[model samples]
Target: MKTLVISSSPREDGNSHVLAQSAIDGTVRAGHDAEHVFLGDYVERMLGNCRHCRRSSDGLCSLDDRYETLLLEKMLPADGIVFAMPLYFYGMPARLKTVFDRLFCYTANSAPQQDQVINGIMNKKVGVVISCEESYLGATQGVIAQFQELTRYLNQDLVGVVVGNANSRGEIVNDPTDPVSAAANLGERLYTSRVTDYRLDTARSNKVWDCSPVGCPDR
Candidate 1:
């Protein structure tokens, strides 16, 4: 299966980036194709919204920016999606929000009308990998909530969520099997199309292939 990994941290050597790389490693190791997109690189510049996207029937954004190249054509057709991000000010960054905001064009399967329906963007497996300073229970609550609402509306399957405790740039590199291993585990699960309740700090596994004989392990 093809997996798209959206690395959303501006810092190339930051904790969030470190985990992102690990996730990509896991994805590549799992024998799947991946497109690594650094949000900071292609999304640094955003065009002013003129709402031309709303008029299109195919959910095409006429914003004349990279959204058409990066998100619509690339992200939509991917078999699995992974959002690698870092919590900022207890929420997501403006750039990441920009991407989500622009998705309004594709929020539905058809144009606005009685026959309009959810586009089912969530049918593909969704995974979240977060890096934040605080390791508190809900440090990534905002990200999780966004995914919850997104998956619910899109009818997508949320496969996994991995939160890495990190602060300074490259702080997670020194840390043992945390953001590194945890991130990889999340990526590996993308191939199996299975959601795991595993945590890096507590439960860590090296298996990437489907191991369950009774069917999908957890939904």
Candidate 2:
């Protein structure tokens, strides 16, 4: 199996990057091929230019940027994807969000191979690791909700989510809950487990991952 791990933190060696690296380590230990990409390095290349132009002859984005390469070469061929990032004002960083936004090209009417693009992106195993400063009950709710809807729309299986509370760079290692280990475990599950549907359970009482320090209040 091949897994693509994308870290969206601008700060090198930050808590989110550490967690992402741990996930990659787990994936490799599971005998799966893992590739890591730092989205901060490609922010300038993912300009959401797809919205302005029609799809190319190959039914891919018309932009001459790296986004098309990342999508067609790295992401489409992977069996699973792990998104790692620190919460930015209760949401994902702009660069990471831009990547998702550019995916709209795959669904555009001009794309000749829309079904192929859809199949390439959908029904894959997905994992998420988030680092946030606050451990409040709903601190990560916004981002969580966004991923849930995204996975649902893509018909992807969202296998697991790990949330760590860390304010400073590389502070997640000091977190008593040890979300780093949880993230690694999630990566292992991404390679080992097979689930057709891992959609969000609306009836679930706790929306927050249990690893949070403060923990979610019982509803």
Candidate 3:
């Protein structure tokens, strides 16, 4: 199996990137091919102006940029994907969100290859790694909810999530949680695990989206 590890941190060798590398190492150890890419490298060509453009006859995005190359050549072809990034405003970094937004072009399109593109995106194994400064219980909730909903919508299996607490670059190396090992384990599980259900496991007493005046009363 081929797995793609994407690091969205602008700083090279930052905490998030380090974890991404560890995930790649795990994938390799599991006898799978792993490719790592820095999402910041594609920031300049990211989707923005294409939002208003009408879909072409081929049902492709109007903007002609390398995102197509990244999606078709790297993302779609991979059997599994690991998204690693630092928390920004308690959510995903803007660059990573942009990539997800661009995927909208593939939806509800009539192109002959649309089915292929959609199928490539759906029902894949996925993993997540997040590095945040705060170790508080809710520090990573926003981003976690986002990924959970996204994978659920795409019919993908979210194998595991590893959150590292690191405020400074490379600080994750000293994190007591040992997120590096956890990330590696997540990567290995990405291939070995099977998808019994695509739904988000929300049976917990305190579900994040449970917005009520009193908050989960059961909790």
Candidate 4:
């Protein structure tokens, strides 16, 4: 199994990235190959929203950008994905969101949503590693719901979420058996689960569309 870890934290060696590194280590320990790409180091251009143009679902962006082509190629080949980041104002960082937006454009245009036919494609499993200034008890559930929705759209299984209590680089190492370790364990579990069992363990929680226009018909 090939695992790809995406570290989207703004900090060069932030706690979130540490968790991502742990996951990579765990993947290797489980006899699976793992690679990581730090989005902060990449020169990715901000992706524009879909224009609803005459675009085809072939995983190719109509516009030329710094990282779009490369990222699309990576997305097509990876078997598993790990998204690691720190929550910024209850949302993802602008760069990470832009990457997601560009990917959305590649997947669909308007009206009905369908799968894209990329040259190298596979149904992959996805997991998230998070680091926050505060504990995981507060508004973190919202983030989990967002990732769950994203995993559903990508047709990937969400193994679990790992949260670390730190705001600086390498701070996650303080807690040896905390979310960082859990992140590593999650990676090992992912490698084993990929071959032994493949099931979507959807967490029963809040409805993502609860605050959407449809969910709030009163609007």
Inter-residue clash pairs, candidate 3: none
lDDT of 2 at 71: 75
For each candidate, the alpha-carbon lDDT, in order, equals 0.73, 0.82, 0.82, 0.71
TM-score of each: 0.76, 0.82, 0.83, 0.74
Q: Evaluate model 1: give its lDDT.
A: 0.73
| Ranked candidates (TM-score, high to low) | 3, 2, 1, 4
**Which model is ahead, 1 or 3, in terms of lDDT?**
3
lDDT of 3 at 156: 87
Off by over 4 Å in 4: 41-43, 49-64, 109-122, 194-219
- Judged by lDDT against the true structure, how good is candidate 3? 0.82
lDDT of 1 by residue, 37-152 (tens): 88866565453443643445544445555765676567777888888888988888889888777565545344342132234354788888888888677778877888877776
Alpha carbon deviation, residue 115, candidate 4 (Å): 6.4
The sequence of per-residue lDDT tens digits that candidate 2 reaches over residues 1-219 is: 999999989877899998999999888888899999987555554545554665555545566557767777888899999999999988999889988887777667766657667889986899999999988859888889899899999988888889999987888999899999999888877855544443586454443344465764321
Give the per-residue lDDT of model 3 (tens digit) for 8-87.
Answer: 88988799998999999899998999999888666544555444564755445666567667788899999999999999
Error (Å) of candidate 2 at residue 17 is 0.4
How well does candidate 4 score on lDDT at residue 4?
A: 85
Give the per-residue lDDT of model 4 (tens digit) for 1-219.
888898887676788888998999888988989988877555456665455342577434456555554465565678888888888887777777776666655555442323442323336777788887776577577778887777676656787788778766788878654887889888887744432233588564454334766555312
Each model's number of backbone clashes?
1, 0, 0, 0
Best by TM-score: 3
Model 3: what TM-score? 0.83
